[model samples]
Target: MKRLTLIAAAVAAAAAMHAPLAPAADKPVSIGKLERVATFDGAMPTGVTVTETGRIFVNFPRWGDDVPYTVAELRDGKAVPYPDAAVNVADPADPAKGFISVQSVVADGRGRVWILDTAAPEFKAPRRGGAKLVAVDLASNRIVKTVVFPAEVVLPSTYVNDMRFDFRAGAEGVAYVTDSSLSGPGAIIVLDLATGKAVRRLNGHPATMPEPGFAAAIDGKPLPATFKVASDGIALSPDGDTLYFCALSSRRLYSVPTRLLRDPNVTEAELARAVRDLGVKGASDGLESDAAGAVYAGDYEHNAIRKLARGSTTWRTIARGENLSWPDTLSVGPDGYLYVIANQLHRQAGFNDGRDLRRKPYELLRVKVNAQPAPTN
Candidate 1:
């Protein structure tokens, strides 16, 4: 406990060395009822992750925040501004703006929270001093590091949506992320943390490219699948050998050997050659593989969570549609449960051509993985 305290103190001190933060909001928070956890409205909660200390982190990307639901650290039950104190980095007069338009959140090995901020709204040109990854020390719920991406690594139209860490890669921890930019073809952006270097691979490959001429059919007619071109969700297998990914609007799921992705020496063509088509499409918006090797997919088309059996194309809906909004990101939390966000994204005004269809408060839900959970009988 003493060691933990020391580490926490060190991280807190580091965050404090940073700049002055914006003032906190002064509104009466409505935490709603518990037992059956109520929802909170996020303009678009694209990613969801939980910390070991049980604090939940959820984000709102480019979408405009009518209510201040940007990046929030859920403490007790209130989604409050984090750090509790403003940080003054180089100068108070040149203080950084508060966290806003965050795309995804993940808990790393050291108990710190990592946030991927798209920075720019709607995958626009990278903004000045924006488009970076921020980490918060769990012990004090404070910001510790802000790693920015170079212009070369992020295309003008790039959208760094979701990311996963592979600590054993590149002599230091490496991060694999999906561009998921709707602008057409997207690239897999790999980050070398030790040196803050990044590279893009498979930018225009057929695999990374959006599904050609694909149209999302939901209300009896063809609709744009959120993004213009489609590529969105990604996941790493439990054993960390294969990287599973799917286009949000396509009917195919694919896996490529992680060896090729982590191998900087490998050519994009070589990486593409390593991809193996996995034949299970759960209408997945987000995909995740739990410790048990079960892939939990949130099927927005069916409004449920589906599981793909190991070593098989067989897929089954594990959790059916139950008041779920448009399910977005998926994560296997430290508590061993499958967590997902139902943001009602597809039903949003942009998808509906400027009419807000979201009724339920965007919610973060947990489904108890049925015990002895053999991938569906």
Candidate 2:
């Protein structure tokens, strides 16, 4: 416990020393204008979600960030810890009881907000009680359920990236998540929400791994360093029949039936055969599906958001420009708008020759669209 305290203290000190200054003027990277919803002046925000009632929530992972809260609700232009600050500050030794390190938050159609706690900051091994899925009652702002991923399911190398719920499946529903581990095999995890039983499907499958010979390039040049992001973005089809996904470091999109993914009797080879290569959808960081069967993908390398309509042969650019430095996540709001977060992930020191090139006021922008997210089912 003392050793962990020292490390946290050291990190806090380092973040204070490099507190973000006023944003530096730089060339804009927008195709069409994005209406600003909120701004993160202190820390860089990676994931964003908006409820049907327009409640906004965002997360700041503990990756070299001095985040006061891991998950928060943005209200009145400021972030307040959702539910309460106490749960957000759960004892590191007993994280399952509280939020440890939250990577994503989604307000499910069932009127509840789900929090995905990576628990293992800096991609470190997840301690007991830290790596779990927490569901909060939006009406009460109270935690109602906590589902911890057992060590066997959340391997030491597992980095739970993103998830989507399919209410059409099972008694309560089922959740599909991407295990985008940087140092271990990439795969997909299926959790039976009603029973709290989870299993790894397509573990180390090719569909979940980074493409061979993949290279993340920007401005016609290879990024300064290798950015091998495995299956990072995932979305379920409107009918709850298909699940679309792509690796951050790869350009192609893939899909498979949700029924096939949830069946425990399905063999590995059979599951592999069911996987369909949906062809190239650009190098995307997040995937979101609308009720019209159109999938939105944030093409990070191109600073654009493209859409693949149902039965479409190729991707069509919906928005693009210098205003989107590195589009990180996509969410379709209830008001028929698509929201995105441009956190300048590629401009970070790791990809910029070891120099922090991120600008202040990392953006939370949205564009009006003619679609709503697929129903929870």
Candidate 3:
């Protein structure tokens, strides 16, 4: 017994010597400091964009919330009806005349803020003249243009999720939109800013459609198999040559040449052949690009922000924390900060068996990205 005890002590000592002397303190890996810019206690905000002069704008979709105004400018922590309250009034009779179920607001960095009106509340079909893009001139705070999508382009099941602009494309530039339809196959809608003509590309393509049998897991709980969103997050390259996009239910990122997308002559088959799968980026909601050519994505599954540097194929986490619950949208501002919305979308009543697990005060968070907003022109 004495010999056995000695042997055991020697083995224990050897193990202790090999182990970390102090069980190295658990250090959380974070690349940037996340700063809370604002909080939404009333209605949840889905999209956020900052102008070159630092004007912050956010949109609240009519998703079962008592949204007094669909679009608002965040000023002094208050949600003020943007441009005025008259335009925000949802007139079911004249849905195209005002903001109805606005889904995203994007500043073109060229003194224009574009509001994308999905006009499909509760994921319902859009009314005639409801689905459109309204561009407001920032300097004048006046509606400069309203392009109502045709019935064919904005399909009955189409949910215009997000869009990015490239002013260098056509005479007045072009806009690329993602149709993240939950009920139907997804596709990309390209709008010619000059003629207000919209064309659908990659319609029901495999890349745009959600991955079969793939469901998102939030907070260690896998979402229901029925929960699938396709072709949601989108970003434009700095040189205006490539457009990168990903589906909400997929981790794979894909890019296609903007030249082909802008060309009406390109056939669907030819365009699909040009799409290059950029491999897995975490399940992302919103994607943004900087003037430095790096693309940033809100990695909702990891509660983090990731970046794919120019000429690099791998994604690196830039910011991560528990507070980043459901990073829903990403916008790179002119102030060299990447703004994100943590709206806890997975906890919504629809996904949580009608329990609405979301807590109050959804967050508008930003992290210093050391990069400026991509040039719109």
Candidate 4:
């Protein structure tokens, strides 16, 4: 896939591309073990979602992997294009016309799978129609609707990473997306589902940007400075009142009132005032909220998942181990199990001196939990 070559050329910041390896921790933390659900011998999978009926779906970004399909349905322990292979094929001339690079696939409780298309393969500049939100009818396996962001909304440097849906927000629903742009400012993108209007909020806010002195380490070595990823993970409280977010390179968690974030009238200054820094919770890549208001965070550096309960000042590790390599995105399935993607992203080619270091048989694992998807429409 030439992803390493593409990323190196895309960043063009040689200074930020190389770094020294840090020392590994002496002992590994022990929590709970993850049960293997499916394995991918090809491309590394990131996002995972299980429908109320126990339908499992996953996505693979064109991050240098030979992904036959960007989004797939896991059936009989294999990944098959959900809707069809044609939808997964991108139009070379116009990548936005089809799925170019998919970063996340979310199954809202309302029986629909929402795919967040970054549209910028190899982390290149985003095209006008490249960044979009596509909703597929789970029952019919057909695309029901699409929402494309305008250039002004999804800037060239924007890398739409993850999203959460609040079906109760607007007439149809509302979506909160994170722009984890490595080379530009990071912010939250809000979408009014009924109108298909997208707005950028907290643009370049301190909370959304990568921590100044923080860098994620893998195999006892820190990633290049250019590997800074900001505002990559997001989650919603059970009551739809609070929205939690974190930077891929950060250890602290932050939150703001959904009401303030949804209110266009709330000025940026006001929204900043509403944001609360919830202290450190380990360097994380993804966050998921359960019906009980507990937020599950993926601690990438420690190969663990931590749970932060309502009103808690500290995070408690729920799962951890060497097998949980680079715990990427997390989903609380309808079957009351936490599904996680251990794609070994830190072991990818980009971080391994331009040599693909990802091992075979990427895993989709689940651990039994007393959690359910947060209520949606």
lDDT of 1 by residue, 1-377 (tens): 99999898767544432212211122211121112233675455677776655567777675665535457666666566454423211122321345435778887746687888776665566565566777789887778877777778777677778877777666657777888777756777888777778888777666666666655554343455545554568777666677777777565678788778877789887888887777646556787776666776765655566677676566655554445545788766565566778777767677787887777577777776642211110
Q: Per-residue lDDT tens digits of candidate 2, residues 209-302? A: 8888887776555764455666789999999999998887788899999898998899989999999998877788889999999999987767
lDDT of 4 by residue, 1-377 (tens): 69998786556433212211233453444566679999999888889988888899999999877888999999999999977999998887875567988999999878799999998878988867778999999889999998887667787789999999998889899999999998888999999988988889899998999998987776577888778888999999888989999888788899999999889899999999999999888888999999998999988877778888877776777787778888988999878899999998888777879887778888998888878888875
TM-score, one value per model: 0.81, 0.90, 0.91, 0.92
Which pairs of residues clash in candidate 4, taking residues 3 or more apart in a chain or in different chains?
Answer: 21-221, 22-220, 22-221
| Tens-digit per-residue lDDT, 63-138, candidate 3 | 8988989899999988899978999987768777998899999999889999999989878998778999999999
Give the poorly placed runs of model 1, Cα more than 4 Å off: 1-36, 67-69, 84-100, 219-221, 225-227, 370-377
**lDDT: worst 10-residue window of model 3:** 17-26
Itemize residue pairs with steric clashes in candidate 3.
none
Tell how far residue 59 is off in model 2, in angstroms: 0.7
Which of the two, 1 or 4, has more TM-score? 4
- Model 3 C-alpha RMSD vs. true structure (Å) is 7.3
Give candidate 3's total backbone clashes: 0
In model 3, which runs have C-alpha deviations exceeding 4 angstroms? 1-31
lDDT agreement of model 2 with the native? 0.81
